[model samples]
Target: MPESPGLDELRVLAHPVRLRILSLLTGAAMSAAEAARELGETQANVSYHLRRLHEAGLLHVVEEVRIRGGLAKRYRHDPESGSRFMSTDPREGQLLLATMAEELKRRSEFRVQGKGGLTADAEMWVDRETWAKALAHAHELSELLHRAAKPPRTRGTIPVSTTVAMFEMRRP
Candidate 1:
């Protein structure tokens, strides 16, 4: 298992399309064609991004099946693979956050209210103990969502979005 993504992997993940693809694969394995259809992207474009992610060790080939006399690889993302993003480079971090922001905007377009959800934004000083607890709680929530994720439009499953960014900021 990979502990963390390297610089090259971070670069690969800085693209909005790739980030969306990762999110899609987290719920289930999918072939490039399937992913392209779901995302409304060209299959060739999706395939290129998929290859980049696979080369960066962020995606795994879960299976291969015959389709139209050719083999199609199904790729999936393992949330437990310990591939969380952590970089000392400010530029890299900015790139990732920008990519995530783009994805958030895209997801917001499809937002449906009245079903109950969480929306939080904070950037204030906090006690050490409170910060520690918040981090733990955030991790727990993320794990819970990832574990409960199901394939797109799965029966009895509702589509949801979760985006969290928590870190201690340096005094400025």
Candidate 2:
């Protein structure tokens, strides 16, 4: 496992393009060209983001495939880098929060646009122990889904976007 990234690294990871690139590489390996095509972005643009992620130690070159006598870098997301959700630096934290909000909105919008997608919200009160158990269960669920989505293995898959949150309802 990789240690958590530093504040600067988190800031770099918070860039929208970098986030999307990382997401694309998750559970799979891809070259910059492929990522660009998948994202409808220019090759140069995606390459820049890929380089930044590599420098930040968020990605690794898993293989190099020769295509037409030229080497193509195959990159995979580095799960060892730990969570990019928070940073010790205030500015980085702000950026992470903003990026997360934007991502939540984007995923929600995309899922709702299609048929038979889930978007749910609920408020619950529980003692600290029960809250901890609930949070633990959520983490377990995330791991299960992640393993199910692992590439180069799982077959016949449809992209699924899930957003789960549990919080105490603050009285306004």
Candidate 3:
């Protein structure tokens, strides 16, 4: 299994732009310029975040292509190698959660109605076995979605948003 990301790595992932970049790369390998164009961000800004994510071991350079006499490296993310953030640091968790909240809100703005969707929220107690089963099932579904992901604007594909954050809480 891959090592869990540390505080600094978590901080690198705590940016909304970086999160979007990660999601984009999961679907296809892309150079920084391509990702920037797809995400509607400046190339310089996306390049910087790509460097940070690559340094933190969250992204891998999968290919290099000659572009205007320079080699542009394409990066990709492997969902199977992704490690769950298991840090006990409250502030770090809060920072990541805040970033996720921002991303969720941004995605909500583009939500299409009248189509099939799911919205679920829960804060309840469950048996240990039940919790374990639920977590495993969620992981399976997440992997399915990632595997099925197509590049942005692919023909005959519908864009969808799936955000999942599951964790066990301590008793008060």
Q: Number of the top candidate by lDDT?
A: 3
What tens digits encode model 2's per-residue C-alpha lDDT throughout 25-81?
A: 876888989889887899999988989888877889999999889998988886445
Across 49-117, the per-residue lDDT of candidate 3 in tens digits comes to 999988877899999999999999999987764476557788888889899999999999999998989
Clashes per model (N, Cα, C within 3 A): 0, 1, 0
Error in Å for residue 151 of model 1: 0.7
TM-score of each: 0.92, 0.76, 0.94
Superposed model 3: Cα runs more than 4 Å off: 1-5
Residue 81 local lDDT, model 2: 59
Greater lDDT among 1 and 3 belongs to: 3
lDDT tens digits by residue: candidate 1, 1-172: 3255566668887898998888899999999999999999999999999999888768999999999999999999887652466776777787788888888999999889887887889889989999999999989999998888888999999888888878778799
lDDT of 2 at 86: 38
In angstroms, the error of model 2 at 66 is 1.7
Give candidate 1's error at residue 142 in angstroms. Answer: 0.8
Worst 10 residues of 2 by lDDT: 79-88
RMSD of 2: 3.9
How far is 90's C-alpha from truth in model 3 (Å)? 1.9
Between prediction 2 and prediction 3, the one with superior TM-score is 3
